[model samples]
Target: MLLFVIDLLGRTGPFSETLPAGIQAVVAGSAQKAADFHVNPPPAAQCASCHAEHFQDWSRSSHARSLTSEGFLRTFPQYLDFVGIRAREDPQVSMACFNCHAPLLKNADSEIIRRVAAFVVAKDINKLDGFEVGCVACHAEGNGVFSGPIRNPKGNLFHASKFSASYKEASFCATCHTWAPASIPCSDVYSDWKKSRAAKQGTTCQACHMAERVGITAVGLPQRKIRSHIVPGGRSADLLQKAVALHLKAAFRQEHLEVTATVRNLTPHRVPDG
Candidate 1:
């Protein structure tokens, strides 16, 4: 029985391929159930619409592909294997993985929660997605924000009430926009800003990234006002490249053995450091 459970936990693979039957059923079915909670799908707000240019930049950025990505996932199996970590089988653990990758759903039931307990006992839990980060991943309704969608607050027609000053405050992003818990060493751009002079100036993640310079839709849709929904975190490869020019130059000690690394922070708090 112990070996059977171990094997069950070890069944992790690429997100593109079919997951284990049990996991598939739970993820797909539970995701649909969570969708049911939203009676109204968010309508295209100012920035809610797609912005090809911004998205292209963001798509090339690391923030867009935090975990739910192939390259990113490849590192995981090897990293966990190196540390002798096993995969988790508990539903709560599953939910937590989904929380960052597919935050649109939940598996908060007792039975599944117990699975989290069991998985914790086994100490083999793995993350849910590769390139797990996406546009709506962090800029969504969750993240403990009272505003509408975190990214395109204005364009999201469903949450008309969110068009307020509180949504624009930097504190609104402090929730999950920062770092992961101690167990996870994920970047925390939010906290960095909180500690910097920017925080004193009251500059927020949205002000710089999603700030409304002019009323324009992401896709150039003619709206009274467009919220910048092109959540470009990691996809802006060019911008990232430009930002890290100094680091790349510095790393190339001899331009031969130097590994030019370009780092781009999607958030202002940890802009390049992150």
Candidate 2:
């Protein structure tokens, strides 16, 4: 649960027929059920067909690489064995692990689960790379539609679109990030955020990670407020540098020089955190 478990874990369309600013497109189709997303979910490439830019930014994010990330892949088998050996029962390995890495695993066909588990058992981790936990994980929810802060005005004949306020709230992230809330354990990122100055001042996880930008999210969309999907964290050198500052001074004594150093934290929350 230390390095491997905790490290895991956004994105448009159309060109002509732009609608008025802040107006969502009129839907000609009913929404799909959540079941549609939970089983054999469409890959990010499907969404990339329309929302190219958002998909591009998302591709660079850790979310895109969660399953195949070298660090996690190297340790995942150990984790599975640890759990299995301890429980000594039918270990629903894919269900427990993929809940965060690949939500589509839940209620998936038995064959899909078997193949994924087989890959894990054989140490053929690379096979899992093509299996993407894409748009369905966050945007598709109980509402039976893909959602965002702003819906694409030039709607597609494809899936139904809707606007959801949950996309604008940090708690939406807690869906996966909350490993232990009451105990405020290392994995409880939401808890850490609650104690942060950013939380007190209303700065959200999206403010620093997703970075606000004004641009067309999809091909036909007009320039409106949008967030980048880059989502940098401690692994980003520039972001880490910005989180803290250091100062030093020296003074000459009668026979020697004395030096003093100070470190100042500039971030809303703790640095070098789990």
Q: What is the TM-score of each candidate against the true structure?
A: 0.46, 0.73
| Quality of model 1 by C-alpha lDDT | 0.43
Candidate 2 minimal-lDDT segment of 10 residues: 1-10
- Compare the candidates by lDDT and give the number of the best one: 2
After superposition, the stretches of candidate 2 with alpha carbons farther than 4 Å from their true spots are: 1-39, 85-91, 109-111, 123-133, 142-144, 180-186, 250-259
Which one wins on TM-score? 2
RMSD of each: 13.4, 9.8
Candidate 2 lands at a TM-score of 0.73
What is the alpha-carbon lDDT for the whole of candidate 2? 0.61
Taking all chains together, the TM-score of candidate 1 against the true structure is 0.46
How many pairs of residues in model 1 come into backbone collision?
33
Candidate 1 off by > 4 Å: 1-67, 75-86, 107-166, 180-185, 211-222, 234-271
Summarize candidate 2's per-residue lDDT along 5-63 as a digit string, tens digits.
11011112231334332122211110121223222354565566557678888888888
